[model samples]
Target: MNVSITGLTKEYGKKKALDAITMQLEGNKIYGLLGRNGAGKTTLMQILAGQVMPDGGEVLIGGQKPFENQAITESICLINESENFKKGMKIGDIFKFAGYFYPNWSLETAEKLLEEFSLDKKMKVKSLSKGMESALGITVGLASRSPITIFDEPYIGLDAAARSRFYDLLLEEYEVQERTFILSTHLIDEVSRLLEEVLIVSDGKLLMQKNADELREESFIVNGPRSDVSAFTAGKNVIHRKAFGSMEQAVLYGESKSDARKAGLNVEHVPVQELMVYLTEKTKGGVSA
Candidate 1:
């Protein structure tokens, strides 16, 4: 389902969690929701999942409001870091509940994944380890098959091996059944290749949103003598800069490599993780798409 937010606002006393956010997310695509801590990533996802109400503005899922609307809420599934399942509940019980909740839930897929993750069906929530809990959540998320499925930092206690398994399963399922997946994660480099689009939020506001491929195409760093680098980056969108002795490196947006080479500057492509770090670092202002 397509997600449309118009002037969405949320507040807690004097702090604004979301500030006049406005954007339309296309359907059946993977989006990497990138942001630092307290940058409103959770708030925005909650608003989309109908777990939190906005003080102002509207969120429409498939042209219908999601807040307090079962029609839309039933089609969306959000798996967060803390699931808060009952301590006495068994893993199999949770799967049964998911089957009842999500219309598209698959019991076959759930059972297969439970074995794949080495999670016992009879194990209670409280008895499982942290990584096991995360694996259970991942199992439900993939088997649920909701039209709009969101994962908000869902790999908190997972080890590297298990995390790699999750990524492989996610890609395999997504290939078989295309759906809108919003992955709000801090491991940008780990999941960069899975994202079709990118959304960056900073300081409770939307900073930038663009096609992942296009963003990479336009992002690069220029390094050379301070004077040459400065002159080459003149009037350009400079997100980050560093200098040592007579040398300088400037991370720029939308500057041509040929232009930088013409000005006697060395150019290199900026990795997505590095670009995101420098773009959102200590910046309160928003960047247009």
Candidate 2:
């Protein structure tokens, strides 16, 4: 289940969203897509899912083009943030429609999730609350059991408890049934633990790609005397730095484990969520998350 995207680019009039982006996503891995706003995460997902067309580049899923190919696209599910269910359609009707499109759709799992989320089937989509709408999308996404599952911030408007439920279910589904999962999100801290890989995009370009474990092992937070902390991270790419009184904390992105260890400073692994925040600072002039 390898998805190869080469030279992917998107433009809206004079503004470029994704500039010659290239990536290869292997099977059965959970990927965290991080970026600032306008970094083109949504555009990338939309193109991959065959919902939007890229101005240039090639997208190959399983060694074939995905655009306009139902056989391939049907196997890929994109649960986007803005899942607008029509006003007249009931929740059950939508589920029924999904069952027709996805051969691997699971009604039992869908029913259980519906009950857990307390979503009423008879209610109109327009009448449901924002959180409820998100829950409906999640239920369909999980039940689809598609080979490639891409979630674009599906937990928006969901409460903390609901979000936790989503995380648990996503992991459980992944463990029992190996599938490619790509998560584009702002809730990095909450979902970081589940990510096996991290892909960061900045200013419409691919900035970094690394194994989750390796990244955590290399990055750390250093706090000490101002001069000492600065000296510790003198040559490192400091994601963030702050000082209060004589004490200073500098978040350094080290390339090697030895670099972090030899610093001889207070060190803690970089939290994926926090790292995203620091790496994509507003002052850097791109997205917020």
Candidate 3:
């Protein structure tokens, strides 16, 4: 399920949430939809899921528009941070309703997940705890078996234990049957490992999109004596660097491991989160990227 979104924009009365964004998303991969608060992550996901219309531009899934079309809609599931569940409805009733709309819905998987989450079918929607409600939402996102499954902070109210379980299940399902998964969360450190590619958005605009591994590899961190580190970092495109007294650690790109070694200094693989912070931080002190 290849998705092509080009020149996408969303407009309110006086605001443009997403501005002329363009990207090509391949199928059967995990994408980390990263951004600061109010960076248009939800808007992009909503548009792609066909729940909202863009004021301009297009969203195509398998060469067809996604809005209001039953054929394409069937393959896309958008599990938002907060879902609109009927307060009067029971858990079983919700499942019955969803099963009809989703052709690939599995009764067996739904039942298994229900037990795992310790949810009772007779319980009213209003009676469930916040964590339980989140669990239910995740169950639908996974059990629906949609070609394009999106979780917009699906573990909002879940505890650390439950969230770990959800991640394990998600990876297991992904391994067995390849599906396109897009997860939007502020908990980058926890979920960063699962991302095949990272898309960073800031201030309602796309910042960068690159292979997770390649980005980490091409960039290296150097920590040692200030003079030695400065000399080693000379002529490199320094994204960021930091100094602690006489010692300095610099984060740099545009150089290979061999090149850093040839300069006679210590280099190590920088974690994705650390590299991201260095790249995005306003006060890098002109060093440590």
Order the candidate numbers by lDDT, best to worst: 1, 2, 3
How high is each candidate's TM-score? 0.95, 0.93, 0.91
Residue pairs in steric clash, candidate 3?
Answer: 240-287, 240-288, 240-289, 241-287, 241-288, 242-288, 251-289
Q: Give the clashing pairs for model 2.
A: 36-287, 37-287
Highest lDDT: give the candidate number: 1
| Every candidate's lDDT | 0.88, 0.84, 0.83
List where candidate 2 sits over 4 angstroms from the true fold.
256-263, 282-289
TM-score of 1: 0.95
Model 1 misplaced stretches (Cα beyond 4 Å)? 283-289
TM-score of predicted model 2? 0.93
Q: Residue 99 of candidate 1: its Cα lDDT? A: 84
True lDDT of residue 257, candidate 3: 77
lDDT of 3 by residue, 1-289 (tens): 9999888889777778888888889999999988777789999998888889998888899899998988988898889887557778998998897799788887788888999999988988899888888988888888888889999999888999999899998998888678999999888778878999988766556777888887777888888899998887787778787799999988886568787787777899877666666666555522223
* Model 3: CA > 4 A from native: 282-289
